[model samples]
Target: MAAEQAPSSNDVRTWERIDFHAHLLPDFYQRALTETGEAGPDGMSAAPGWNVQDALSMMDRTGIRFAVLSLSSPGVHFGDDAAARRLARRINEFGAALVTEQPDRFAMLATLPLPDVDGAVAELEYALDVLHLDGVAIETNARGLYPGDDAMRPVFEALEARSALLFLHPTSPPNHGSVSFGRPRPILEFPLETTRAVIDLVLAGTLRRSPRVRVLVPHGGGALAVLADRVATLAPAQMDLGDVDVIAELGALYYDVAGMPVPRQLPALLQLASKDRLLYGSDWPFTPIPIIEAMAAAIGSTDLLTDADREHIGWRNAVTLLPRLAALAH
Candidate 1:
């Protein structure tokens, strides 16, 4: 895997790179976190301050032509069902305005108030039908309840009915304190939680049933491909997977090259995901700017991907996943 010269800003300007896993931090959302006393939710530090211009500048510097935004971990839901519903609407509205302001450079996924099924279903309908947002972004677990829980079936059904895209982000796992050892959960637990949520969806038949609801898994499917074979071999006998082909099901979902995907995670991810299912992501504000730049450079320079594969992951695949992007292209 020889390295190629990183593309310069001029060179990058000519290409279309669509970031599918970027985030936004609206002022109202920050205030909600503080008011809820969840400023340090999941054991991480305070939320990073973000502004539209700064986000645009980062996209330009990294050669990203467009970014699909979502509200990140410890999502809009705090504890109160009503509060969660209100915050979800506020975040969605804020994101929709950004897209309206710059349709070519920005798109947004709607936030939902999960763990409150009826509210979530209503919000999903409004976000997709009324707001005309690209898709929905949801936490892997909503306050310790995984999306695959039977209680979430209606939400998945609603998404399928709309053929909506689902962006799955990870938050701290249930009872993470028991395993976290006082460290921030993102370091290790985030990936593990993503893996767990995906498997649960498969075992619960959520993925099988909701074929139209396209799911985008973050961080190269979060150690999922690495453990896929293990689950495929043992899950049926030990658990009640009931004929689910773990590898095939995993391969069907889209995955983003966020976090540290290059050198190691990407290879493992390819074992389960086809090249067309790969997408680029720069989990900005959460992953600092310098790291995002370095990761973008590495993706451009990595020899493991052919020029064709690079093109697909950079933007082609994203366009296929969200057709609205092609319409928005300049």
Candidate 2:
């Protein structure tokens, strides 16, 4: 691996204006590709298409002062527990090293071999205690098991104990649904799956029990934002205890502006969520990084929020969620 360069004087354009979600492939994954000389699992984008330099350049151009990197979808689901554990360690270490090399520009969200509850718990400890990562990133469903499932209680317990930040990225569940039968992943399914996992966590008592636990839901919080009212009306028994309006409960959680660039969606989200709870995300490598600048500008242009609201959404909110960054501004 190459040494990371220090951020230039110009690089410090705006402290704390960071992107909370993006991804990278570790060296082990590259080795696996090199040794096997084969394309990875189908319907997955885990290939070595992007790297750290690309990420940094994007940040520089977009006026983003920092970024928190995490592993993308299908995380550790492709291998057995041992393989998954080893891969997660390598990825987490690489992420930590990247942050260390460029302390001014990066932070990390640790990856875990989830559903293997023991391994996930152990990985969380190692990543936080050893690597000093800011948070953990887990997919919507780990091998067909939702975060609400009892099997993942250990991971949740460990995270809740530490008030850890969890970045929830959506992945298609096993045999998700028919999407033209041949279409790849079906764009609709990603948001739908995210909605499913979000509801599962709320209804299964995960959110209520872990009040301190902060979760960053991707793709504009998926269908959960759109269907909050509908889910609220399902039944008192259908949801986790407390207010019937799941949408109101969601306001208690957090969201990133990863995919909600459309006019209607952003306003609806603002109406439902407090300004301080919204954060910025680029979904880089998938969406063009330059698009992030456009999104940021669009967000700035919205009358639904005040200048303070835009500033919070653009950066201050992330700083609040990631308390570790409190000292950097000086």
Best by TM-score: 1
Against the true structure, candidate 1 reaches a TM-score of 0.95
Where's the lowest-lDDT run of ten residues in candidate 1? Answer: 7-16
Q: Residue 151 in model 2: shift from native, Å? A: 1.1
Q: Per-residue lDDT of 1-330 in model 1, one digit per residue for the tens? A: 899978563244445689999999987888888998888867987788888999999898877889999999899777799989999999999999999999989999999999899999999999999999999999999987899999999999999999999999999998888999999998999999999999999888999999999999999988898899998998888987667898899999999999988898888887888999999999987988889877877777777887778888989999999897787444
CA lDDT scores, all candidates in order? 0.89, 0.76
| Native-referenced Cα lDDT, model 1 | 0.89
Give the clashing pairs for model 2.
Answer: none
Error of 1 at 191 (Å): 0.4
